[model samples]
Target: MSTSTSTSTVSEEYVSTASRPSDLRITDVRVANLHGVPFRSSIIRIDTNQGLVGYGEVRDQASASYALVLKSRIVGENPCNLDKVFRKIKQFGHHGRQGGGVSGIEMALMDLAGKAYGVPAYALVGGKFRDTVRCYADTPSLLDPHEMGERLLERKRRGFTMLKMDVGISLLWDVPGALIAPAGSRDDVSTMHPFTGIQVTPKGVEHLASYVDTVRSIVGYDVALAADHFGHIAIDSCIRIGRALEPFTLAWIEDLIPWQYTDQWRQLTEAVAVPTCTGEDIYLTENFKPLLDAGAIRVVHPDPATSGGIAETKRLGDYAQEKGIAMALHLAASPIATMACVHLAAATENFLALEHHAADVPFWSDLVTGLPRPLIQDGYITVPDTPGLGFGEINEELFRQQLDPRDPVFFAETTHWDGEFSHDRLWS
Candidate 1:
């Protein structure tokens, strides 16, 4: 497919030299590190021989090295042939933060593909299911339940119809008789849920339940509410906490245990009244199959940065729909990743709501240009009809202001990663 852009204003045009997708060849890969936009993040830029640059971001808290290391593999390929390039590099990815490289590249490729075909990213996958994507506010935890409720009410005042909050053992640390942890197990965060031997007492359950009750009383039943980050507690405690909070009618309880324990997830799902949701740390669509096949979860939450970017995330959502499960996305990165999720959620039929982690960051929307101000309004983001992931360009001034102090590089040259040292093929 051949495409052309007019020599218009910077916000209305993409600077490019080549007009045909067939002639596009990747020339270089670079990264910009940003910290304290809320979380540490790395944004990637892939330059092509055609002057068409595609943008993406690594998973929040993941190293930029994850993407920089793959520069050698994709330096000379066509960005529009996504699956062909994905297959060649996906072997380098695994679950959790390790998957960031492949997924980010996939997003960049999708962006280039859309621009090459003169369509939005959603069109390349299929057509969109909705014109605007609904977003849920992700709030941090506070020490006081009433204070947290008031804080959530503030989000509701801003027009969020859905919300998620942290309700974990972090709250019970001070209350005497609230927990039963053996010696050396009091502040354990590394032990697996099954081996932790940390149990929430009856008082602990009541204490946690009261927090949700306060929030529910303030927010009312007019909006959907979800809870997460319940600490590394065992399944029995997960079930207990899930049952106690059932009275408030939570939308779902997330990550009570790790996502890999499908059998344990099934047991918790069957035992609780609230819907069980997971898959944020999961890498690809195939790994989600065991959870869907066993009826272990009611909702699947995949961060595009960790779940394999726009196309793979769409595939995962489609497969979950076939199994009668709903899909919600977990996102906590820059505007590039947010727009990617917006396109993915727009195209997926069973999509629930996209998480907006930067709702409170004043400069978050300023990171990109050519989009509406207050990018989210009345709890929804209007999907862009523009080509690619649908933003004009990175707001260089604002981006520079948020650069990570440790490595304040803005799309610097990456010639060191240009030479491939070993063969990358999986089979002869």
Candidate 2:
């Protein structure tokens, strides 16, 4: 059953949390940087005059500048005016990491609106399908079968029921006759998938299959397992590898082919018994339509940080639900972004699981307050009824301690990005 509720029919005044007509306005847009071991990611804070604030994070490795640049256009607008506010800044967001800013801004706005209205973010979108969102452990791929098995088994021990691993030709470099270098390009994955000539030989396929077999032997058949980052090989190799691993019943072969090549995706889906998944690099629903329409892949992976935030992600899920396609979220961000995924996952009926890429970072759960201490338990995030995103605030001392030595901890007044430099008019 779908817990999704259409609150649009409910008047804003009726949902107000402050007991008044809900006249809160955006006051400040602040940015902060947090580290994931060596990698640095950005988070945003959208404050309102009513003392309610919303927090969000940009896509991993993207700049806080992406979110800060939009402050001028967003400040002073009513955070509750989502449709209008999103459209106003939607023009500023483009594909890939550039979309992070607009998406982050939208997330912050949802939190603000949810807080002012005293509701969870999911309630603002639709209701929810589950109180808890399932998480898949995104454990790093280890080349050594013994080590990989141990690593995956540790994830199982840690309580992640579902798991994904990095597997591909990159890990097979030492094996004999595994990959053929392209005609002109270096061994780097610079060449496109099909043209890369990075053929995965039969020996290569068996080696990779054996590795997954080792993982399956340790974790057993009950838990769902997925494979990702298999190098930039083409469709033929993808099918060969997928077919070889068919007996393992791998959950899905992710990004086996690049996301844009729909025909290839369709071919991979048709060729293999295992499922296929993609769409993290994709920006909005428009880009995903062709993939869905073609029935290209069995699963649609939309990273909330990259896929236009909470509402747009639900739109993706709703679209997938109609087409009978499952949706899995790609998350490699902070708990703030992960919680956004949790709220959206609760609301989306088609949701499968949300990726918990930061499980290895001990301080990962410590980054945010007010949410649960563990953030994830037994591979699931229990939804909180607390108003807004339910994350109280960023742990300033811990955040500063984890800051990228190259950047400052929080917003240092992005006045340079405060104003629009050029007119942005699409219509004549």
- What clash pairs does model 2 have? 3-128, 4-127, 5-126, 5-127
lDDT of 1 at 260: 92
Lowest-sum lDDT 10-residue window in model 1? 1-10
Segments in model 2 whose C-alpha atoms lie over 4 Å from true places: 1-21, 183-187
Clashing pairs in 1: none
Q: Pick the candidate with the highest lDDT.
A: 1
TM-score for candidate 2, residues paired by index: 0.93
- Candidate 1 residue-wise lDDT, 57-144, digit = tens: 8999998888988999888899999989988888888889999988998899888888887899999899899999999999998989
* lDDT of every predicted structure (CA atoms): 0.91, 0.84
Q: What's the TM-score of every candidate structure?
A: 0.95, 0.93
